[model samples]
Target: MQAYQVAELTPGLGADERREFRDRALSSARNPSQFTQLREIEGYGEARLSLIERYLLQGTPDASALAAREAVALSAQASQYAKAMEGRYVAALLLMRRVLLGTALVTGLLSVTSALRALLLWRSEMDRRARREARQREALSLASHELRRPLQSLLLASDLLRHAETQEQRTHLLALIEDGAAQLASRADLTRLNDLYLDVTLRPRAQDLRPLLERFAAPRVELSLPLEPLVWPVDGDRLRQIVENLVENALKYTDGPVEVALREVGSQPEVTVRDHGSGLSDTLHGQVFLPYDQGPRGLRGGQGLGLPLVRRYARAHGGDVTLAAAPGGGLQATVRLGQPAGTRAETQAAGGAGLLQARSDAG
Candidate 1:
């Protein structure tokens, strides 16, 4: 409309027409708000937009055409920038989704693994407790059965004593009663051995072990010891019990003479009781050390508490007991005692000659 107005105008044009054209041109120019919006974009071709703004203000036909071309170029540049930013935003969203998925998967696996491990531990503990309780029940049953026989014999012998006719008859009845009472006492001691040992503190003092072993020497049992004195700090009563139990256990299974050797190994006193009989199998060896566990032999008229008590007594004196197969096809039970300082000479002095002296002494 401005170009048409410029072409049709004559020098004699009215003042009102010129004033209306000027007002329309000003209204058609770019608004200040459009310039503010274009400037706000990050890379909206600022140089070209400024040139277009300057051309619009000139208000000539040629300048208006140039400004329109610059405006088109600015719009295309803004569109390209928008497309590139859109692609980057989409890629970032995908990366974030993958990270969240991986974290969730790892968390779930950790929770499952912890739950399974806890369940396995709980199951193992329950199984162990069940086995212990069962063993305890069996021990109680066996004890009751063993005690009944002696109790019945005692009752019968007591009734028989009341009706005795002569001196011989009374003596026989008394002997039977005495034997039954002794058996009952022995059984009671074996049954309470663990508790008794646990409660009793060891009273260790320096004592000779030769005399103690000599007391146990018999036709079926032989001894080897240092002739001078197998002196060691020990609880005499407990040490005696340890020797007696080993010897008795040896004799129970073997017909040949049992060998008892007292020697020193590495500054410690070691007593080994060996029998030339059928030794225990590998599996039975461990079982025999458990209370009331007789392994394959069951109970051969003896409580299965001896070896366990032997170990307990040994450990009380800061020692331990180990059983292994003897060189000549039997079981060898060894008692090792913890020696204090200044006992190395006595222990190492246990030479081969002690076997001859031990035999001579036994004879």
Candidate 2:
């Protein structure tokens, strides 16, 4: 269009000026295309400008008339190209806006999901903590109550010993005092064991368990063995405690004899203590294994830590303790020890003193 206007106003330009204008216009027309219509406009306009240049050189009316006619056609093409480009630009802007909206929706949904998951986890953790705290409080209360009886017995015996009048009376009072003192010492040992059982590690060694089992045998307790040194990797002191607690617990509830048996069940060592008295119900049996939960028959003269300690010590050796009703009429308690016992001891906390190498000579 500029070239057409220039030709109409100044058709008599110098030869050099006309050549320069023609070169500049042709160079722009040969450049790369942005749109098809834009390319077409440049090509068509270049041809019309070349025709006008020819008219300037020839100074003829026919050449001028042809240049004028081509000018009108070039103008119409430019108008259409402008409107087409505007419509394309609007369509591109709308597509970009839709893409942004979709991205925002997906991001919002993810944020809401993450927040809800965190809230649910927090509530679950809080509920678990509350139950644990309640259990601890109940256990502490039961322990305090159990300690009072032994303490009162000690105090009463000591008071009666001071008031004795005769030698015989003094001897009876002294025996009472000794008994009370023994009870207090036993209670103290149980309390200490309860605290250490979970935290302390096991000190297992390869040794015969027959001698240990023999220590508990008496007229009231029948012993069954395999007629060989039942050797296994075990913490002797812990095993002794386990047997003692179960035997004493049985004696406390029943007057009949208790049977203590030792043998290997599969690769693990097993100890079964069966009492010939009426066994506990299924519900009470389960409750007695919980710390300080002695059921309705609250562990006659016991702190209710016996079964719990037995189970914990057994588990520390990577084994477990189970209680079931015997076929005839009794509660059979079984304690199983883990295979390759030294492996589990490495992962647990350091335990109490090591067991003495000397086995008990008592039968």
- Candidate 1 lDDT score at position 138: 51
lDDT of each: 0.70, 0.68
Q: Which residue runs of candidate 2 sit more than 4 Å off their true CA positions? A: 1-195, 340-363
All candidates: CA RMSD (Å): 22.9, 20.0
Cα displacement (angstroms), candidate 1, residue 140, comes to: 11
Predicted candidate 1 versus true structure: per-residue lDDT over 1-363, tens digit per residue: 334246335466676765565445444444535444455443655535566657756767686666666656766776867777789888988976775665565567567557768989999999999987776555454445445656887999899899999999999889878867866775457556334354335656566677777766778888888766656677776687688778878888888999999987885689999999899887777779897676577646677777777887788767899888988699999899974334335545765354345444544
For residue 300, model 2's alpha carbon misses the true position, in angstroms, by: 1.2
Candidate number with greatest lDDT: 1
lDDT for 112 (candidate 2): 53
